[model samples]
Target: MESVRVPLGERSYDILIGSGTLKDIGRHLKGTAFWRDSSARTAIVSNPTVYKLYGDTVYESMAEAGFEPVKVIVPDGEEYKTLLWAEHILGKLLSAKLDRSSFIVALGGGVIGDMAGFAASTYMRGIRFVQAPTTLLAQVDSSVGGKTGVNHPLGKNMIGAFWQPSLVWIDTATLGTLPKKEFIAGMAEVIKYGIIRDSEFFEFIGKNKKDILNLNSKALTRIIKRSCEIKAEVVSKDERESGLRAILNCGHTVGHAIETVTGYTRYLHGEAVAIGMHMEAHFADMPQKEVARIKRLIESYGLSTGLPKDIDEGALMAAMEIDKKALRGELRFVLPETIGSVKVLPVKKDRVLKALKRGG
Candidate 1:
């Protein structure tokens, strides 16, 4: 197993990446300060589907380790990521008699991880939480980052915190059950890392797309580890997204707007990101060769580079106006300067509308 440290001083944690870490979570947690205290309780927060599959195993493992665990299952889907769901989790933590010393285990996809992490962050001002991310999207991206929150009616992940995780357990074995579409969605973020910082990784992904799609263990492990390393480096340098971290939002600014406009049902996060990348590329100042390379890589992963056929261009542009990245009523975009390089540009409203039209 390979471990990457997030380096947040008192709030720092390690990300464990491997194929069977889930089965040995007890051993993994045994060494952490959060678990060393015998009096600490743990709540395993997950969704129904994951609970049916691996929840019991996790619970049993913790029980065998002499830790009392309470299980809380949230309904699946992005729509369920709300204040109501967070309140429900808070209620469960209270009913379980959890205190500040207790820890939360988010054992599912990004939605569960985000909500559970948020619960841990707000419970009594801040408790401890671990991430047991199961899906490719979670493992390669969301699971490692400290950003946690739920969706609001106005936007995606609008109400959130920068609370770091106590530990991140990435078990590649769980990804075997992930549907092809979900797996493809994750490739969007993986590709984002290459676009923003690593040209060689981009070429590697382009060459090994088939093996990656097939879920080759070695390939998946390398991708996950590398992606985490890249993200960790970025987050470590810019914890609160004051500068360099903004590059990570290469596709997220417009992507989140897409999710909000569609009510989170029309496209998955990475799907919207895929479209966002395509549109951002059009506005980039990169060489034509690099632009073509990005386009080819995105298409190679079976992701759509176009907007949804039914989405209205005008509404989409209006949505962009409200994006969190906007400043002084000016649209800010993370656009590529070249493969492995990007910059945040303040785009004019007219230019944004034009980009929306092109994307649509």
Candidate 2:
């Protein structure tokens, strides 16, 4: 198993990544010292889809470790991430009689982790939660950063809190059962890490495309570990997105707008971000050739670098204006200066509209 430590002083935690780590989850939690007394109950917050797949193994493991555990299942899909669902989870935790001492284990992908962590943050003021991310997108990105929230009608992640998890439990074996579309969508995030910080890592991904896609064990481990490391380093410096952390929003500005305008149905999170990255690159001073390289990598992952024709450009622009990344109605894009480099600058609405048209 490979572990990456997210250093947030007292709130610091380890991201444990391995092939069969899920089976020993209870023991891992106990080792954390906080969970040493397993008499306290745990709520495994998951969706119907993910719980159906690995629920038994996780529940049995916690039970073996002497934890009083119950499954709190949420409906599956990005659409289900909302304040209403968060309320449902809080109700379940209350029904289980979970106090601040109890743990909330988020046992699915990004959406589950976000909603479950949101509940853990708001319940009893604040509590502990574990992020056992199942999908590649979750493992490499959302599971690490402590950005927990649900979508609002007007924007994505509009209502949320910054609550770090006690543990980010990742088992690479789960990727084997992920559908091809989901797996392909996840590569966009893995690719984002390389674009934002490690040029050699970016080149490494380009060279090892086949093995990575084929689910070769070494390739998966390498990408997942490196991505976690980059995010940990960033989160350690700026835990609350005051300045340096905003760089992590490379494709998120436009990406979130895409998700919001489409009502979370058309494009997957990674897919939208892939297109955002491609379009946002042009807003930077980078050479056209560098932009092409970014586009090629996105395509190799079976993602599009262009906006869908069905989407209304004006509505999409309106969504961006309301995005969290925007500054008082002004557009701000984390535009790439080059591969492995980016800068966040306020963009004119005209520039954004031009980019949108170009994307089509």
The per-model lDDT (C-alpha) reads 0.87, 0.89
* Per-prediction TM-score to the true structure, in the order listed: 0.95, 0.94
Candidate 2 local lDDT, 115-181, one digit each (tens) = 9999999999998999999999999999998999998986567899999998898999999988889
Candidate 1 structure quality by residue, lDDT tens digits, 191-264: 99999999899899999988888888889998998899899999888988889899999988778778767977
Worst 10 residues of 1 by lDDT: 31-40
Kindly state the number of residue pairs that clash in model 1.
Answer: 0
Clashing pairs in 2: none
Among all candidates shown, the one with the greatest lDDT? 2
How good is model 1 by TM-score? Answer: 0.95
